[model samples]
Target chain A: MGIVATSFRDELLAAGLLVPLGADGLYGRAAAFEDVVDALARLIVSLGAADGAARIRFPPIEPRSVFDRTDYLRSFPDLTGAVVTFRGDDAGHARLLAAADTGDDWTELLEPADAMLCPAVCHPLYPTLTGTLPAGGATYDLQGWCFRHEPSVDPARMQAFRQHEIVYVGDAAGARAHRDRWVERGTELLADLGLDVEAVVANDPFFGRVGRMLATNQRDQELKIELVVTVASADQPTAVVSSNCHEDHFGAAFGINTAEGDVAHSACVGFGLERVTLALLRRHGLDVERWPSTVRDRLWP
Target chain B: MTDDVIRAVLAEHGRLAVDVAALDPDADLYQVGLTSHASVNVMLALEDSFDFEFPEQMLRKRTFESIAAIRAVVDGLTRAEVD
Candidate 1:
């Protein structure tokens, strides 16, 4: 098997921006890459600063109990990741070691962990937000590491990534307004950074037979929209930012209520840090210093 | 007959808190406690009972909004089968 260096991912690896692990979708970031990601995160915060969104951060893995309440497993079982750990005794451990020595399937010996990798940044916050809200509702500035099990060589799609999200939980009108505003703002922000960007109606990759209907329904209602940019190819653009209106889905799931005694509607705008960085690199070049003056000033200045 | 089957399917798979039989044909199922997650179950069950697959065009929320909507869609698909 010969690995070619013609791909964008290969170029990143060659330029020392991304350090590849043994896996297809997993990688370590070099200092230069980390700096770009950090700058992007800061830019996101600055853009949303006027909104007064309360900042919150959580670890990548959330409790399985909370994960069970979400519809992720039902809709996206293909992308869901469940944490498992070894809980075996001495005999079991010895067997596991023996299997490891012989290169057998030792993962079967592991037990289900109490945690699962969070698929979205806003998911874990819903549990804390159960109960009624105040007058105008709440807005949160959240950033976290999110996980999905989709392994691909696209480099844009990673198993592990960071999301900087602005989440609003309130009435239906407020939620939709939040999503709509963000759709415009997010597109402008990305476009200003020197990328060819567009906001388009999009749907989640819902799973299975019934999921097809759900995807169509979602698109019909315009519940989700994404700001996409060409990262890998001209034909296929990646979603660098997305605005979604959950429309009481999370409120119903987590029992969150509004000031008006109705189930609260939730919306979020998530910016993919790594994807945007990659988009910038693809648009400009791997050398950050050599980037267009406008782009450099927007990020570093 | 189609309405009865839709009702029975709703009773079994809708997981709704309300009684499906008592609701009006135009009632919004989602407002009556039917969730998006449960709606998938309802959609699959409806497919099983009708023995017809829903094309992408007919898979909107309006198709499953009420008993009448479900009945209409089912009738159209099965009638197409007869044709």
Candidate 2:
């Protein structure tokens, strides 16, 4: 159904980068796509440093208490996926197993919510704010394993993926500068990969009533932009990466007082490593050696 | 303990910074410019430089935030093995 589907998978694997994650025989649009995933990600952090963004890596998971503050759930409710464990009596476990065997989901039998579920596209800057700041504004590049509860049949859009975020948590001007630079630079870099991509001003998909207000506000502020390409189909271009300027949302929520005791705002450029790799593979044939000389030299070498 | 080792290792990675030693033992890794991806890069560099395997448990937060923290973990992991 897609470029990474069984039909075109081997074509991509011939590039020598696509490694199989499952036996679907779906030729996953990219070779060692996971390595490409990592390579592009490393490129992301390196870009952050080049743009003068401080680099930081958070735990793959975030504290639920903090995730609630950002209201990430309110916006990405559909993209929301979680990891939860079931604890119950042995009889209950046996019942659940039997139910599962019978093709009946026994999830309703146990507590739905208990420990921390994965944060949907959320990075933890709160823990990083130990009440200090540089004389100037600060920019940070954050990366972690992010999960989405919803699964897509498209290999490019996996249920679980990695995100490299370069955030500017400081003054509004600094935040804008940081986000703007990456939005432009990232598009150019993608172009270098020999892909035709565009940067579109976008917004977060907020959940309910409060979400409506936030989503609209996000759109108005032009705070988020996605690097989109026609992968699934030319008519329906999909977003591969995002660059966002989150103003003071993180600063106010995290009590991240600056050196002068002012809460510093924040912005970030997020790279969907898998999607980018998928885009690159779809752009060029899967053969690693045949990729653009520049991209090829950088990656394979 | 010297720049040559770190620099030589970093030279292998065209993009990643090689000044990992600049990081303090407890300084927040992000604060010292160590993004998670870069953390992996540095780890890879260490692996290549020392030519050994690091214990998986050491990959946790207790030892990754600072170079001193990483060195201690790597040094411990490397030293405890048969050379």
Candidate 3:
């Protein structure tokens, strides 16, 4: 790691914001960090409460069948984490114990579970809404701990992280408008919280050669926007929030229709709680008490 | 020569859904399915083929939106090199 990343990690560890789990991409959040995360979540909900979105929370794991239907494995096979269990007989268990005693790999005895870790917060929402919508449409506010298989030491990119998303499921215009509105709102919210943030046109990390085309198409169409803040490096800012427009992709896939029987277009604005908290720590020093009074008031008061 | 070189590079490395020969030079490559990831490949191929690095400003979507746009950037970079 470079000087900046190394120092940042040291500062976080010293301040109790991050508790090292002796594993890459895994860290336990201390009270101060969790407080910031919870405060941000409350702030987000307060900002979006008027939208009348049906709030739903989901577990970190989702059905494998539902995940397959979303085509996430096809697009991001490298980042999908499948949940597995030990389905061994007593003899097999004895061998597994022996392997554990010898510190050998016991993963061979594990079997794939019915579910995989949730890749995106919105993945489980579509299948549940698989039908015609009301006249105008429906909106959802979902938050959960989402898991991805990318293991990295970068504090900003965690293998297990929390995501809060306000998803719009409706007509094309409504969905587009919802995304646009949140883009502005999110920028203002971050700014008000005393963080420098910019919303830029961006693309998802698509897989393989064909995925390259998908990323370009996404950018060209302005289908995705990211709220970026300078965390570890000013030159390479990290994206803490993302606003995406799915544009009937999910509607068509899940058979969700509008009142007129047309496929519903969808959009979502997602905030990575840990990334936001890290951004706050990066902007204002690690000491919560020493942060700007206004930021402190917003988060604590 | 530059146009032919651009076409050849894209054909060899673009991983495009459609034939490079069939694409309109001015048409939006992204609209036709040139992905952002593939665009990076196209950029690298152009840089290797022409022996020049693209400036940071030239890395946006507009710089590679079409075959014509890519040709323009390459021409400008090569011209700058010669001058």
Interface RMSD of each: 2.2, 16.0, 6.5
lDDT at B70 for candidate 2? 59
Better of 2 and 3 by TM-score: 3
Each candidate's TM vs. the true structure? Answer: 0.91, 0.67, 0.79
Residue range with the least summed lDDT across 10 consecutive positions in model 1 chain A = A1-10
lDDT of 3 at A151: 76
> Order of all candidates by DockQ, from best down to worst?
1, 3, 2
Model 3 alpha-carbon drift over 4 Å, by segment: B1-83
Look at candidate 2 and tell me the lDDT of residue A216. Answer: 52
List the candidates ranked by TM-score, beginning with the highest: 1, 3, 2
Report the Cα lDDT for residue A77, model 3.
88
Can you write out model 3's per-residue Cα lDDT over A180-249, one digit (the tens) per residue?
Answer: 9999989998998899999999989888644665676688789999999988778789999999998777
Candidate 1 lDDT over residue span A126-219, tens digit each: 9999999987889999999999999888888899999999999999999999999998888888888999888899999998766887787788
**DockQ of all candidates, in order?**
0.48, 0.01, 0.15
TM-score of chain B of each: 0.94, 0.62, 0.92
lDDT of 2 at A88: 86
CA lDDT, candidate 3, residue A35: 91
Superposed model 2: Cα runs more than 4 Å off: A1-31, A51-54, A112-114, A117-122, A208-212, B1-83
Candidate 1 TM-score to native: 0.91
Against the reference, the lDDT scores of all candidates come to 0.88, 0.64, 0.85
